[model samples]
Target: DQQVKQNSPSLSVQEGRISILNCDYTNSMFDYFLWYKKYPAEGPTFLISISSIKDKNEDGRFTVFLNKSAKHLSLHIVPSQPGDSAVYFCAASRGGGGSQGNLIFGKGTKLSVKP
Candidate 1:
């Protein structure tokens, strides 16, 4: 049973455009979140993260927002570049209460930024 779901499997955007990726979760107990970007032959790289205590987090061209009431989250990339093309995965975990913080991941949405 998948706890996280990325509704769209792919997204295409032109260079310098904005790319948005979405994800939904079944569990309401998840407290921590993360996003990872993966290239074809490389491992997923850490991108950005947010905690349930905060509604949003931003770094450079990447932004992540969490909607606790909806059990949903989204990643936004502005000024998209060709090098930004990758599979983006949304992940979450329970942060406290003696938990080890195991992350649940979405299938990922492949983003293609065309130049």
Candidate 2:
């Protein structure tokens, strides 16, 4: 089973600035990594993901980066706004032989974008 770790419990960013959330994993065999954002009483929404074959992937204001050797990944949001405040979780899956066919999630980092 793949385990994801997000050491930072919370992050504060000023509006118009950048927010950087990090994630680390114990499994080197993880073939896929994803970032999800969650709001109160709402299900987590997929943000971005990166494959083992690629070091980075970007979509709109979000970007995901993967460092295979270190088994670490990060999500970056530029021009952070108040609406961007939410809990962000990092997930990983080994995806093939030993996978549980589900994503393993980190503890989640709460982001607060102050105006």
Candidate 3:
């Protein structure tokens, strides 16, 4: 079973518009949530994170909101640009303070921006 799921495989948006991506999880034990953005042939880079204790986290043009009760999360990008096009992955981990932070990731959502 997929612990994390990104139902939409792809999304397209115009430049300067807002882009939203959704994610869901099945595991209730997961305590830490993270979002990563990746380009082709390269590893994912950490974008933002939110602990189960909080509901929202933001960074500049990117914002992530989590609903622990619903086991769902979302990422929003404002004024989307062509450079923002990439695969976004939602990840979750059990927060026991482990080494390297092992994560279970969703299949990934590819975002396309038209300039």
How high is the lDDT of residue 81 in model 1?
Answer: 94
lDDT of 3 by residue, 48-73 (tens): 99999999999999999999999999
Displacement of residue 72 (Cα, Å) in model 3 is 0.3
lDDT for residue 111 in candidate 2, whole number 0-100: 100
Ranking by TM-score: 1, 3, 2
lDDT on C-alpha atoms for all candidate structures = 0.94, 0.91, 0.94
Poorly placed runs, candidate 3 (over 4 Å)? 97-101
TM-score of each: 0.94, 0.94, 0.94
Ranked by lDDT from best down, the candidates are 3, 1, 2
Pairs that clash in candidate 3: none
Query: Across residues 1-115, which tens digit of lDDT does each residue of candidate 2 receive?
Result: 4378999999999999999999999977679899999999999998888999999998988988888889889999997999999999999887665446578999999999999
Total backbone clashes of candidate 2, pairs 3 or more residues apart or in separate chains: 0
> What would the TM-score be for candidate 1 when compared with the true structure?
0.94
Residue pairs with backbone atoms closer than 3 Å in model 2 (clashes)? none
Expressed as tens digits, the lDDT of each residue in 40-102 for candidate 1 is 999999999998999999999999999999999999999999999999999999866555478
Give the clash count for model 3: 0
True-structure lDDT of candidate 3: 0.94
Looking at candidate 1, what is the lDDT of residue 104? 86
